[model samples]
Target: MALGFEELDFQQTPMGELFLRRRVEPTLGADVYEVKLGDEYLMSSLFTEAEEQLAHLGLAPLDGSDLAVLVGGLGLGYTAVAALSHDAVGAMTVVDALPAVIDWHERGLLPVSAQLTGDPRTRLVLDDFFALMRRDPEARYDAILLDVDHSPRHSLDPSHADLYTPDGLRRLARHLREGGVFALWSDDPPDDDFMADLGTVFASTRAHVVEFANPLTGGTSTNTVYVAHSAG
Candidate 1:
């Protein structure tokens, strides 16, 4: 029998203290894994619909097989795993700033670790996602799915703020193949302002409201997935 709660791992990083913990949920009678950075709860296995949708919505517009995908923020590996579910996805590169988070997945501490690490198509890279996008990359991807920041208006770090801007988005678009898709997961509701900014960089953009059951609240919670298509 599993205990009520257990702290799986902890690490001190430049951002803050990171923690991975597992607890037996009384309501679901199952083990729930969660990650926290400092006092902020990063992600939980309990609610992953939005995370999964980030990949689905992002790739829905893309066509053809052997797709190359890039995923930012490998939290719990849900987004990366979900992206791999598509047959068209030939290769997937997941980038994260914190190496400790990558270690947790490599160590199989998280539930979806096996699905992410076992697949030959998946490449887990320990790097700042934003920094990579800012640099002149040698390769471009068919799709880019990002789930790092809380929202365009709310960023985990100030350095991430620029990525939301029109110029920053344009730079990100440069890394995408023609007609490539860019999808983002945001905790905040749809923002008209951000949509306008995305309009400047991509050919088309839409915000999808993904609602999932909230076990703790006994109701539904919603997250936003913003999908944009590059003009080429």
Candidate 2:
């Protein structure tokens, strides 16, 4: 029998203190895993619908086998796992700024860890995803799924702000193959201004409102998934 709560791992990173914790939710009567950065909750197993949707909606537009995918955040491995569920996805690269986060998945601390780490198609990279987008990459991807920041208007670090801009988005678009899809998960509601910027860079853009049950709250909650496609 596991204890009610346990801290799986803790690390001091350049960003802040990162913590991985597991606790039994009395209501659900199931073990829940969570990640916190500093005092802010980064991810929780309790709510994963939006994270998984980021992959499904992102890859849906793409049509081709042996597709290469890039996932900007690896939190709880939900997005990556979801992306791999598609038979079209041939390879997936998951990038995270913090090594501790990757270690958690590698060590099988998270429930979806095995689904990510055990799959030969998955490659876990320790790198700043925003930085990777700023420069030209060695190769282009068929789809890029990002769930790093809170939103285009809010970010964990100021440096990440650029990626949301039109100019920054242009840089990111260059890394994608023609007709490639870019999908982002935002905690904030859809931003019209951000949608306009996305339109400027991509051939088309759409914001999806993903609703999921909130265990903490009795009612449902929503997150935005922005999907854009490069010019064909």
Candidate 3:
């Protein structure tokens, strides 16, 4: 058996080992890009429907002009790019904890990197997203799209676990303007416990299940996009 891909880059982040890989999927006869942390798969080009939907569903509900967005977790840049596709979006700031992931975009290792960096409205910030939200008490945004974790129940890092808590979610609300939207991508289905937690922080919250073809398996798979709003 020959190798289907090669490791283009790898980094030792505080959380674990981060790997960027390009592989050929013989089943579908297409090239697939993947990001892996340790032995766990974080994201892949093969399954990007939910990531894009996080932006679509979140931005679709907004009215008026010049929307400001903050994308938490740079992942493969799918959500950020999708958010920018909206003409009403005036600005977007993508924040990530790992410098190596940001470096991957700066180096043009991914498809959406060029689009995100070249656009005047987009700004990529290297920082811990949760920490930044907590630190910037006066800063606010129209929308904040988070793709940092597997789910509210399954986090990549333990510190990130706090973001799903009531205190942490309130911190996110602080950085969002009145009537602002908060959206997040989860690889798992919507969790009732998490949705209940979200209800405690925001006035309204909903979960969208995005379905896409599963090339590996015979049927389809689904991911969840959770959206909430800060009251006016």
Candidate 4:
């Protein structure tokens, strides 16, 4: 809550005009921001918890076999950076809807993402995530991580709702390799029906509750990550 560094303005595509500032305590990890006009805080470079959660959940099924990871949405590049860290990962495909966010990384507005953007294992795809997945029936990935919107229930884009629907789940299931994982990040806990839908598509499903210390807001904030795996 206390002042840490000079405040700077960042321009997002659909969101537009974001304020990024360093956190005094940084309990969340390192860098944190209070986005103007929104209650949701932005985690920048200090993304240890989120990155670890993505990698831990996505890589659990792979027994060191080379696998391809498809990551939807490259926010702060926490998940992409984390997925690329695994040597068993043969490739990482990152798809983001907003070109402005991608430009920010290319221009170095977001340092964490910029680093991963330059990584050799990464392939950047600028497209609508849902459309991209829908068009690629033959494409298969060992793990697919989706962190596009804030949460499944509260999406910045109305179109994101389709991703949680039964039809969307079916398309997602088609893109997975045997025993592959599908991970989604949600701001709040997942609904029972949402979990059930995931179960229908994947042979197994699990939800992970991630708790992290909030520097600006006291106490702890928890984000739910839903992980589902295809039948081997």
lDDT of 1 at 187: 96
Candidate 2 residue-wise lDDT, 24-105, digit = tens: 9887889999889997898889999999999999999989799999999998999999999999999999999898889988
Tell me the tens digit of each residue's lDDT in model 3 across 1-232. 2258888799998888999998888998777889999989999998889899999998877898899999999989999999999999999999999998989999998878899788899898888897787786656789999999889989888888888988889888999888999999998888999899899999999999999999899799999999998788
Residue 132 in model 1: lDDT: 88
Q: Where does candidate 4 have its weakest 10-residue lDDT segment?
A: 28-37
Would you estimate the TM-scores of all the predictions?
0.98, 0.98, 0.96, 0.84
**Model 2's lDDT to the true fold?**
0.93
- Please list the residue runs of candidate 3 whose C-alpha ends up more than 4 Å from where it truly belongs after superposition: 1-3
Off by over 4 Å in 2: none
- Model 1 lDDT tens row, 57-83: 999999899999999999899999999
Would you give me the overall lDDT of model 4? 0.74
After superposition, the stretches of candidate 4 with alpha carbons farther than 4 Å from their true spots are 1-48
Local distance difference test, candidate 1: 0.94
lDDT of 4 by residue, 13-70 (tens): 5655555554544454444533342455645454348555877687777765668889
Query: Can you give the lDDT of residue 121 in candidate 2?
Result: 98
Q: How many residue pairs clash in each candidate?
A: 0, 0, 0, 0
**Candidate 2 vs. true structure, TM-score:** 0.98
